[model samples]
Target: MAKNTSGRGQRELRVKVKTARGRKLSSTLWLERQLNDPYVQRAKREGYRGRAAFKIEEIDDKFRFLVPGARVVDLGCAPGGWLQIAVPRINALGEKSGKRMGRIIGIDLQEVEPVPGAEIHVLDFLEDDADDKVKGWLDGKADLVMSDMAAASSGHKQTDHLRIMALCEAAAYFAFDVLEEGGTFVAKVLAGGAEGDLQKVLKQKFTKVAYMKPGASRSDSSEKFVVATGFRG
Candidate 1:
């Protein structure tokens, strides 16, 4: 049984719709699982733009990244959940607070509603023009470059994994281009594991590179995060 911590049980309560009419079994199962997910209920209660915010939060708590005043860039930042977490964490240190002052800029192909203190741009990071736009917005190098982008699934497991790996590789290249020395880069990867070539490149560029799966991520999901810290520039 999922507890409604918000005290608004009625609002959080999802209708348990039985499979009816033409609804496929898989679709109905997916809907039922989502409805019963605790994180989804918490996200709704907390007013987060999306439940993905918790993944970043849990990752940060473990790694102690995203320090005060850090200049950060978020790739595939649609719905602005990560940005929502980044702003307060970055701002918390205040002036003269630390090595990196909070400055978060997010980019996505989809439009995201403005987050109070974040600079957001609507553009695909894969486009040639996108880098210049993000750089212009940043005005300097970034302390961290994080991406949660995943390619659309093809239902074929290997194909889907390869597509997401490609996205991660592209994101890493962009991270290398923009990250300041001693910076950090994080991106989502599938359980099939990162491509060997990409792993070799990341290991050479960063002092520490490791994979993590946060508690917010569904246990059954294959998703994991690759964190590369101490950028050598």
Candidate 2:
């Protein structure tokens, strides 16, 4: 079951969504969970595009990778939430006084609405030439490459786990190509038996690798983030 908010001066009367005549129970349950989720409400109140913005927010809060003057690349950057968070933190718009300006490029398979102070591209990061293209766009190697990509769910747990691990590994290899020496890579992955291989691979390339589950993530979710820093390039 999903958690709900309470306490004085906060929300009351948890929203209950009755199933429509043709709706599936899963759909009804999902709607109810979204309505009750505190992070979703906070996203609306704080002007983030979605709750996922907070995941990166929490991740970067600890890693401190989104510093001013850092050049960043965001793979699978749909809806532009990560870009929105990176812009100000990286000083993409030069809003911070006496801080170095930063640059970020976001790529996705679908066209995303433009986020101010960031560049967005419709691209698939798996293409053979994708790394070259991103290099061309950035005009230099990136200081950090991050991803929020996940494979489409097939409703089978093991298959889903393997699929996401494979995607995360691909993102890691892509990072190896475009990241500058000592850069960072952050990505999402599921917890499963096969992740040991992914960890082994990252350990070879990064000086430090750590995992974190942000508070914004649902307690029931299997998702966690891998933050690999000090790219050995």
State the displacement of the C-alpha of residue 120, model 2, in Å, after optimal TM-score superposition. Answer: 0.5
Query: After TM-score superposition, what is the CA distance of residue 208 in candidate 2 from its true location, in Å?
Result: 0.4
lDDT of each: 0.87, 0.95
Give the alpha carbon lDDT tens digit for every residue of 1-233 in model 2: 85555565464668999999999999999999999889998999999889999999999999899999999999999888899999999999999999999999999999999999899999889999999999999999999999998899999999999999999999999999999999999999999888999999999999999999999888998999999999999
Judge candidate 2 at residue 47 and give its lDDT.
90
Residue 11, model 1, lDDT? 57
Local error of candidate 1 at residue 46 (angstroms):
0.9
Lowest summed lDDT window (length 10), candidate 1: 92-101
In candidate 2, where is summed lDDT lowest over 10 consecutive residues? 2-11
Which of the numbered candidates is closest to the native, going by highest TM-score? 2
| N/CA/C clash count, model 1 | 5
Cα misplacement distance, residue 29 of candidate 2 (Å): 0.4
RMSD of 2: 4.4
Query: Model 1, range 52-113, lDDT digits (tens) per residue?
Result: 99999999998877878788999999888999888888883354454455888989888889
